[model samples]
Target: MARVKRCLGIDLGSHSVKLAEMALDGAGVRIIRMLAETLPVGPDATEEERNNATVNIIKGMMKKNRITTKHVVLCMPGQTVFVRRIRLPRATGSRLHQIILFEARQQIPFPLEKTIVEYQVFDTEKEREVEVLLVAMKRETNEEFMRLVRRIGLQPIGISITSLALFNGQDIQRINFKDISSKSGGGLSGLLGGKKTTKKKSKKDATGEGTSGEGVDAADQEVLADLGGVPAFEEVRAYVNIGARSTDVAVCKPGEGASVGFIRSIPLGGNHVTLAIQKACGLETFTQAETLKIEKTAVLSGSFEFEADKTLYDMDACQAATQICDKLISEVRRSLDYFISQPDGVGVDVVVLSGGSALLGYLAGYVEERIGVPVELSSALGNDQIKCATSYGDEFDYTSFKIAVGLAAQGLGIGRLSVDFLPADVRSMRDFSGQYVEFAALIGFIGAMVFFGSQIGAESEAKYKLTKEKCEGFTQKNTGGIERARLTALESKRSQIESKATVLSDFVTPRDYWLRFLSHVYQSKPARLLLTQVVCQPNYLGVTASGATTGGANSGAPGASSGTALPSSSDPRSGIVWIAGEAEQLNVINTFVSDLEQSKGASPNQRCVVKKATLFRYSSQAEKSEYFAPNPSIKFLIRVEVQDEEGCLLTRLDSQPFMEQTALPAAGAAGMMGGAENGGDPSAMGGDPFQEGRGGGRPRGGPGMGPGR
Candidate 1:
């Protein structure tokens, strides 16, 4: 959205403070509202007292009117400001500004540094000169007004002189001028003109006769009285604003290459008129005089007509009104005549009356009559061309709102001539502060956006967590039964793999014991010994070397000194060891037996004894030749036994590390046969054949069978 600009014009005066708000719509300007409040104290009051009163009034007015805008322009009372028209040789803009400052130093009474100066330049097409309307005010006076505005929470955008503001007010109204011939009463044409002066030259002795009127004849009267060759529209015009305390006279000639021709302020105003009336009539209070001036007073009127209580003070009012009006008229005429006396001065054209006192009865007509010019009363509120907001009252005194409206017009960029006396440094600081506020608002907006974005993200994260938990719960409920079935299948597969591993381990382990026994035998035998056959059984008992006869028992093997009968060779549990080999000498056979008894391969608690050793000589040449013996050699059969610490036979299959400890006692042949008939394989008597066990040989039977046949 595009921003709309609103301008507020404030008029500070001795008697009252006025505010006028205006806004531009397209090309037209509309007056939003106007407010005015009388000062609580008089002119003799301190600045603090005046400012406090002014601040309170402004605050109440803004609140009551609901004024929201802060862009404001102030009107400096003409009395406090210095206005000058300085003409300079044709120069560039930069040079012109410097010339004006120099001019200010020479022309202005105040020090250059102590004043705030502003200017507007007008170019003359016919002359090589530029006229500058310079407006300057004391820095302290400007600051006082600025502080007053700021105390009411407003910073003015511009500070303008009251005369320019009054001119602006009249220009915006476009007041019409009446047509009048040069011969009109006292040469009172459209605008104010200088009084015609007549001179008669006395004839000397040579001529003896002289005309009474010497200068201009009747035919040249218009020419002599006319303002020097300038057009009526461009003719010098004056604005006489009769404020409460002083009257500001400003001359603005629009087209004659001049904006503000000149401006001056007279110390006489409505208050003076009222005081004069009070002194003449012997009024007890000034308030009654003011009331009389407003009600029964008529300036320059011979008879003052009272609307109320006519019998009491009619004559006195009449005398007072005439005397005050005569004095005011003399002052006004002198001011206008002085303006016209200047070089290249066209003098005041039309007089526009404003300010609160301009509303005094017959004051405008009396001034027009005395100064021989047309006087028009105008105010910001009363201007038909300017639209007023609905908030304004119809009875509003538009006269008092002139300066404020003019100030507003300046701020709205519609003034006829705009000049500001605000110091450059102060205006720059105000602009900077405005920019700072805008920047801060932008930062706050961005921060709010970021905060909201974070809040949205947090909400999304919480929703995601809730959704994830729900998914986990659903999976556990729907897939639990299938998971149990899967566990069972895995367990069964694990058992089969474990059984195969055990079988492999058992086969490898038994080889250690078998190799032990064979190594001992080989080490003990002489070099000529040759073994063709070997048998080992756990349950067998062999004949003892002591040659004592003992019972053969599968449960317990008798001592080596007590020979015992051996079990069948195929019964691995008989704990018997047999060997058949050929040797050339008997010593070799006896040495092998003795070494076997002492070998580490024997059972821990028993000795390996040569229970029987049979030697037979070779009966056939084939046998001898097969043995590879040239001399006679015998074939020997030897049987050895080993026992546990308790003299029980050491079973062959049970010799494995795994088989050493059992949950059930080892079964005999009858139990083994019975287990086979029931359901178990007879080969299973050795348990899992490949189970991890302590043994040194391969299985004695087929792949799936045990040692015993």
Candidate 2:
């Protein structure tokens, strides 16, 4: 088994720090531990004080969780990083690096030398243009984060933004859910009831009327148009992560290859709601207001009214929280509107909410009602790829650790974006660490060479001559008359054994040629192409002779057909293979022919087994056979000429008039060459080579030819 790797993803947010320990192996990624610690510093604390608090909290969390993984992936706050999607010409290597660097200089507010810039190129529908997601951060901020990681005895490998991390986390969860659903055949829809599953309607149904004159109302049609009818906004999803001090929004196109199309950060979050509650209730401390908000506040949406027994303080807290939420939702709406107004923008179909504040009661409902889109609370606990240990407790806050999970997923090579913000000095350190073993081995080699050279130089001339003479004397003594005679006898026996083995190999090789031929054909066939018939003939002239047969049980050989005689001087290893198949597309047939022509032996120097592969006959309007009903497909017949490993068939093929004869006539002429009534089964021509103790014996017919009718 391959070695298992462990990585730690740290989310250093304003309110708390989250650390997720992930174990990755061939099986998949598993969450070994997740720990969160709140920062004790107040909002008015200095930067140095906040940094100290963060470092101390992370240290405590690691010690409590017993996490020994040193490699770390850190998530930078979205507000601190600048992210832009730029269009550039398709390039690679140094050219691509230069282009991105130039773009970064123009897009980033900071100077190039003082910023850490990373870009990821995305695939687009355009042929010549590529979309690049460029991210930049101040070098000082990056160094400060790295220093904090080092202070905690961890190695920082990658730095990613919160918005991108949220996108990645949601994407991986959806993929894992789909994979599990496929395997179980239940789709896990009942488990994730928060998500809306929109059923696609046909053109007639989408046009708002049925054949019986029953029609959908204007409101329903408008909703459908908003959801999916627009071409530029199809299948888009938004991931909203509301942290303590800010909210990150990532608009993405979701499908097999999901990508973030737009990203923005709003400076309103749960902290604003806490401050609002504090000011409304006239609380002495912010902590008291936070407690009141968590205990009594619930955002009222729609027609939900306050309870008759509710206190004035409770009402005030709820109203304050609701007002902050309203403002936050409005900001999110503005961001989405701005994105949709762009030329290449896509409308979000659904919003998935995550973060520490997403756990608030009725928040998802409020967001849904305000944003006019379906909302779901993101939970990593139910994801198939993330395995939680029993010690983590059943009440774990899965949503709050989403960014950490996404960062760890990127470290495990599961995320789509491949951006890294490690400085050059760190990269050089990692590279040197990776090659330490190689450097040690090289130093050892030099040391051994030097030691041996010194020893050789220290040896006396007389001693060297004595050692050489002793070795020569021993060789002379060993090669005397009896030894020479014994060596010659051994050589003679080896030669005789080799000659016998050669004869046996030649006899056995032909018996398995049909099996090899069939195996190669099966392996080369494309998934869309289905074979209907296959026939092999030893030589071109023998096809006519085989077709002349009816049921001559006593023709030539014991296994020969009733009215046909086996071709004389036929070599089984060399033959013409005829294949007939049906394909959904013409390209599948062409792909099959190309594979056969390019197929070669295991060794690089060995020649291709197929001398030539030809498309003998093709018909686009071929009738569907009884086996394949309803839909018609393209029918094709291929003629593949194969040669023996020894190339003996090449001489015979060149000497014969094979090329002058068309493949279709020969295929029809040998129609009766592989039939069971002629004492052979077409399927048994390649007798199971995998079966043990099999011999070099033909199956009741001439070598290489199977019975057909």
- Output the number of the lDDT-best candidate: 2
Q: Where does candidate 1 stray beyond 4 Å?
A: 1-4, 175-236, 254-258, 302-313, 379-385, 390-397, 433-709
Alpha-carbon TM-score of each model against the true structure: 0.51, 0.55
Instruction: Report the error of model 1 at residue 466, Å.
Output: 32
| Tens digits of per-residue lDDT for model 2, 1-709 | 0011667778888888988777754344578888888899766678889888988898788777677787788877788788888887765446766877888898898788988777765545555666778888888988877777677677766677888877767666554533433332243332222133354653333232100011223332322223222134346888899999999998886433346788888898888888899999999998998889888887877534543235533878888899999999999999889889877886778888999988776788889999899998876455555666887655666899888888876665455454666666776676476467799999999999999988887786669899999988887898867877899999999999999889756544224556667877888888767776675655533432232222223222222323233345555345666676667666788899889988744342243377678765454244564435665666555667776665333212222323222122222112223222223233322221111232111212232233211
Query: Candidate 1 at 418: error in angstroms?
Result: 2.4
For model 1, residues 1-709, the per-residue Cα lDDT tens digits are 0012578888888788888888865323578878888887755578799889988888888888789988788877778888777667765446656777788899999898888777765555435666667777888987777767678887667777787888777655552211112332332221222344443422211111100111112223332122222343644567778887788877765563235566787787877777778888889877788888887766544222333344544456656766766776787788778777777566676887778888876677667767788778764354454567776656666777778888887775556455766556766665566467688999999999999999999999999999999988877886758876897899999999999889866533232344455555667767777775555544433323332122333222222333233434323322445555656765666676666665534454333333333321111111342554576654444555543332333333333321111111112223222122233333323221111241111212101112110
Model 1: lDDT equals: 0.58
